[model samples]
Target: MNKKLLLICALISIAAAVGYYFSKGPERISVTQYKVAQGEVKASIANTRVGTVKACRRAYLAPAIGGNVAQLYVKEGDKVKSQQLLLKVWNDDLTAQLILHKAQIKANQATAKQFCEIAAGTERDSQRLSRLKKYDRIISEEQLDRAATKARADRAQCQAAQVAIEIARAKLEIVNTDIERTLVRAPFDGTVAEINAELGEYVTPSPPGIPTLPPIDLLDISCLYVSAPIDEVDAPQVKVGMSACVSLDAFAKKRCSGTVSRIAPYVLEKEKQARTVEVEVKLSDAKDLQELLPGYSADIEVLLASKEKALRVPTEAVLENNQVLLITADGVLEQRQFKPGLANWNFIEVLSGLKEGDALVLSVGREGVEPGAYVRVEE
Candidate 1:
C-alpha cells in the first residue's frame, strides 16, 4: 500500500510540471494588425511663398539725378502716395546753380528786347531811305547804304539774343529739374519697403559695381500672391484659375484665400540646380493680414483632386509598399500589402490594404509590434 501511494504522488508531480511548462511558452510580441483593404494617403510638399506684388514699378528706387542724401523722411514702413516726398537729397549746389540760370535768363531777355528795339529803329530808317530813293530827293546814296548795313546788323543781333535767351531758359529748366529730383517722392500710394540711404549719406546715380551705390527697394503690397512649386508629376494637375488657400508660419492661425493666377506655360530652369516649376497664386485682399508683407512666404493648398465618399485609412495603418500586418481571429499577425491613393493631412486613401471592421495598429510606434506577433485588440 505504501509503494502504490508513493507512485501516485510522483505521477501528480509530473502532471503539475507539464502544466507549468505549457503555461510559460516561448515569448511572443503582442500587436494589432489590419487585414488588407482600402485606405487613403495624402501627398503634399513643402514650398515657399513668393510673388511680385506690383508690376512695372520701381524696384530699385534710383533718381535720374544723383546727390547727397539730405533728409530721409521715410523709413522701411512709411506709407506714401504718388508724388509724395519720400526723401530729400542735398540741393544747395543745385539751388544755387538754378538761381544763376534764372539771372542769366533775365539778362538774356533784356538783351533780346534791346536788340529788338534797335532793329525797329533801323526798320524806320530803312523806310525813310526807300522813300528818298523813290523820290530821288536830296538823300545821299551813301546814307541809304549806311541805313541798310545798320538794319542788317540789328536784325542779326536780335536773332542772336533770342537764341541766347532760349539757351538760358533751357539751362534753367534743367537746373530746376535736378533740384526737384533731389526731393525723392513716392511713385504710388505704397509703404516704404526699404530705405537705402541714411541721413547725411552720400548717394549717386551711377553704380560702380560691388561697393556700388545702392537704390532703395520699395514694395507695393497692395496685392500679394503665393508662389509655390508643384512637383513635376503633379505639375500637370495645376491650372490657372483654380482656387487655393495659403498658410504661413508668420500667421499660423490664419488661412488666406487665393486663386491660381497663372501657371507658367514653360518650365523654368531649376534654381539651386534642382528641377522645379514656379506656380503663382494671387491672394484675395480679404486674406491680407498685417503680416502679409511682400515676399512673405506661405504654404498653399491647391485643390488638385477631391472625392465625396472616397475610400481612405489612417496613414499609420499602412506599411511598406502596399504591405500591412493583419491580425487573424486567432490573434496572429499576418503580413498584407496593397496599392494606395490620394491622401490629406491626416487620412490616406488605401487602394487595397485594409477592410472595414479590421483592427490595425494606429501607429508604427506600437510596442512589441512586428509580423507574426500576437496582439490583443483595444479601442
Candidate 2:
C-alpha cells in the first residue's frame, strides 16, 4: 500500500511540472510594425530660428530740405510708382526766390540785347568814320581812333551783359533745384507703409547729431524673400539655388516655394550662444506674396537631396550598424543589414536589402526583441 501511494504522488508531481513547463513557454515580444513603402526620400535641413520676411527694397523717406508739410499725396498703404511725387514741404519762400531769379535773368537778357544794339551802332559809326578818313581825309585820325575805341568798349559791355545773363540763369536753376528738394518723390515702385506727418506739421530731416522721424515709409513688395539663419555646422551643405519650402506664421495653411538666393560668406555672430549663417531665399511664386507684407515671421526647410520611388522606412526602425529588424514569414525577428541612401530625421532611404511591402519592427529597446524571437504584432 505505501509503495502505491508513493508512486501516485510521483505521477502527480510529474504532471504538474509538465503543465508548468508548457504554460511558461518562450516569451512573445509585443511590437509595432511598419509597412515599407515606395515614396520620395528626401534629406533636408531645417532652421528653428525665426526668420523674417523682407522686401527687396525699403526706405524711410524724408524731405531733403525740411519745412512745414504742405502736401501729402499718399497715405498709409497707398501704392506709388517710381519718381512719383509723394509729398511737399512748405516752399513759398523758395518759390518766390525762384521767381525773383527768373525776373533777374529776364532783365539781364534785356540789358544784353540793349548793349548789343549799342555795340552794333557804335561799330557802324566807327566804320563810317574810317571810310570818310580814307576817302576824303576830312575826319581827324584822333576821331577815328576814338570811334574804334568806343566800338571795342561797347562790344566788351555787351559781352559782360551776356555773362550777367548766364549768371542770373544759373541762379535761377539753383533756386529751382532748391524748390524741387522741398518736394519728396518716391524712389521706387512700392507701397507706402507709414505716414508720420500731417499737413501743416513740421517735418525735419535727420540731423547729423540728432535722430528724426521719417515722413513716410516705402516698401517694394514686388519681390519678397525670407532671410533665415542656418546652423554653422549645417551651413556647408546649403548652397545657392537649392529648393526650399517656406511657411509664414501669418499664413499658416499656405506654404510657398522658394530657392536659395544667397548664402553669407561668413558666419553671423548675432547670438552669443550659437553661431549661424544667414541665407536669403527668393520666392518662386511671388504673385501670391503680394498679399503678404514685410516683417512677417517665417520658417524654412531646405532640401539637400531627394530620391523618388525609393524604398524607405521610418528612421526609428533602423538600428545601429545600418541593421534593421524585419519580421520574417514565421513572425520571428530577423536582423538584416541594409545600405542607406538619403536620410533625414524622420525617414531613411534603403538602397538595398529591403523592398516595398516588407514589415519592419518599429518599437525601440523593448524586451524580448532580439533576433529569432517571436513577436506578436499590435493591431
Task: List, residue by residue over 35-77, the lDDT tens digit for candidate 2.
Answer: 9998888998877599999999999999887799999998999
Instruction: Please give the TM-score that candidate 2 achieves against the real structure.
Output: 0.85
True lDDT of residue 29, candidate 1: 59
Tens digit per residue, CA lDDT, model 1, 1-379: 9999999999999999999988977455545444334433335433432433333244557666777777777778777778777778878988899889999989999999999999989989988887879788688888898999999999999999999999998999998887887777777767776677887777777656545545566667665676777655567777788767677767756454677887777766566555556787776766464566665556777766555555666667766775666677777677777566776666676656566666666545777777777667654
229: Cα error in model 1, Å: 5.3
lDDT of 1: 0.70
In terms of lDDT, the poorest run of 10 residues in model 1 is 47-56
Off by over 4 Å in 2: 1-21, 24-30, 208-212, 252-256, 286-290, 316-325, 328-339, 352-358, 363-375
Top candidate on TM-score is: 2
Candidate 1 Cα RMSD (Å): 4.8
Pairs of residues at least 3 apart in sequence or in different chains that clash in candidate 2 = none
